[model samples]
Target: MSSLSMASRNLRRRKARTILTVSGIVVGVALIMVLLALTEGTATQTNGLIREILPAQVTIVNATTPTGSGAGIRALFSSGYNLNQSTVAEIAGLGGVYAATGQLSSTAYLNGQTVLLAGIDPSSYPLATNGLSIQSGTSLSTAPSDQVVISDTLAGQLSISVGSRVTLGPNSTGGAPYTVVGTFSSSTTFLDRSVYIPLSNAQGIAGEQGKVSEVYVKVVPQENASTVAAEIQDKVAGVRVVTSTNIATAVSSLTGTLTTVFAVIGFVALLAGGFGVANTMIMSVAERTREIGTLKAIGARSSQVLKIFIGEAFLIGVVGGAAGVAIGAATSLLLSSLGGGAGAGGLGRGARLFSGVLAPAITPELVLLSLALGIGVGVVAGIYPAWRASRMDPAEALRHV
Candidate 1:
């Protein structure tokens, strides 16, 4: 029989101990797989969302101001920054710019529940020209001043439909009542929970007439976005210009940090699994001393003995790693599904944060890397025991009890 076959038989001789050791490796590998899936999945989802929402667009925010003498103590608050209709007109007139729109945003209460409110010039907004479509009722262009459009998700939450009058702001006494002229659907999550009204109406309600929180610019198709962004920055004072790519990069960096933190935790579990493997191998060596002596006497070299032990460890790793991958992938899918359901139902803020857009994604690279790590752990853990077995004096091993 071959050394590897012999090793396999020996492992089968102690089924319970072998199972316990393999379980340790399985747990370690599963932890690593889950961590990688969550981090990578979140990054991919965030980037996709950024592309969908901000594609070929430049977002301009209020610029930062120095707050202290220290290098990193500058205050980047845009609390007082406000854009007006003239600014949007100026952006539209700039070279390489196709269109511009102003947005006014604030928080307001609807039927005792807080909701996001956004004011936009529907004609100039990119969503109006893109994938946004009214599912019921008419567009903002024909809607009256007291009428507003809302997302289907938000409408469901409030149990209100088209032609329904919803009170906005504090309450009936302090809030302004508006008719739901339309319900719209889009590919973005944020938009799905938002209420859209005419720019003038939002400004009047927020008591910030003629003022806007931000401006969205769509550059000409043939122009480089970065070049247009730079030109906008040069032309517009006290505003920060950022491209869609920058948003994606920022999100990726955040996810990368989270991945690193979780990976360290997974590493700790793997170390524990490695120790379990080493302990099992050491015990196996002790139990098989007499067998080693017989093999040596029958012409098995020191290298051959070493290979037998290492091969046994490698087999355990292969089995354990495969099982772990299956379990981890299933767990990730279950968690993501649950989270997505909760978010779609408008359960809570935390639940919505991890809903459909942040589901775990299992990639082939993660599986291969995790499997290799498991095998590597087993090989490293087996080294000392294999070395001890190979170094035993044949006569002494033969005399072992």
Candidate 2:
């Protein structure tokens, strides 16, 4: 028989044991594939969404503080920076400022639960609708009335839908009724829990006329957005200027901390799979020691012996990786299918949902990573066994039972 046929026959000698060993390698490879796919997909969508909204502009905002009040003001008073109407007007009139607009936001309790109510300028909104993530309903298009947009989370919390009326208590100007004209949410933290309203309407609720939360400015054809930001900082008082990039960076940094923790936890599962492969391979090596010696006695080189063993492990990894990828993909799809594709209740991470299915993106990089990790595990696990086999004396091997 040819060397290849003999090796194949020998591999099948103990089918059960071989299958078990291969199964371990497969699970390890699969774990790596799933993690890589998920991380790559999430990072791509989130970072891309940030870019779409921010888009090289600068924002002037009032820094917040805690309001200290005793007895009569029993409720918590959050100190907020309100963008002065005059400051915004001045910024809009500046030479280099391409576009300037104002916005406001406050925390309010609806049915004893906290929800964010944000006020945006509807007329100037098209100037920078990039910031609002419209998951469902229509964008804030109608003239400023008592219409408000809410996030999917808030929608779910309130169990309300578009065109429905709900009471808004931005400071309890009688918790006046507002129609839910639109709904929005970002998969990220920002939009997922917000309520949007026209600036004029919001003003009526807060009872604070001519005051705003921030003024966003887009610079014209200049890489030095910061230069204009500096100019705004100099001209404007009681307010701070921040670039869209700056806000993205700050939010990204905070989210990154959580991602890092999850990444470590995800990687630990990979390590556990690796250990399983190593343990299984080691045990297989011990059981097949005499057979390895027999192969070596017949002039099979050390490298060939290593290749056969590693190849076996690799085959197992391929099987497991394939299964794992399918499972992970199904999970992403499932999330999208459950009304997560569109509307406020959908997945906020900009995942493309089709036919009510959130598809987990399978990319080339993930495939490559899975294969590479499999080979790495196989080579690592084969080392000790290959060494032991290489060191066996041919004469002594032939004498064994």
Best by lDDT: 1
- Predict model 2's lDDT versus the native: 0.60
State each model's CA lDDT, in order. Answer: 0.74, 0.60
Tens-digit lDDT string for candidate 2 (1-401) = 54445434545776776566555555555555544554565555545544543433776666442222211111111214576666767888887887787776666645344565667787775573355667778877657577878887778877988988788775444477778877776554334666778887776666657877667677776686888888888876666676656544544454455446645755565566556656766666666777777888777887777766665555545544555555545554564355354543223322332211212356877777666665566556656655665566766766666
Residue 77 lDDT in model 2?
Answer: 18
**Structure candidate 1, residue pairs in collision:** none
RMSD of 2: 7.1
Q: TM-score of each candidate?
A: 0.80, 0.68
TM-score winner:
1
CA displacement after TM-score superposition, residue 59 of candidate 2 (Å): 2.4
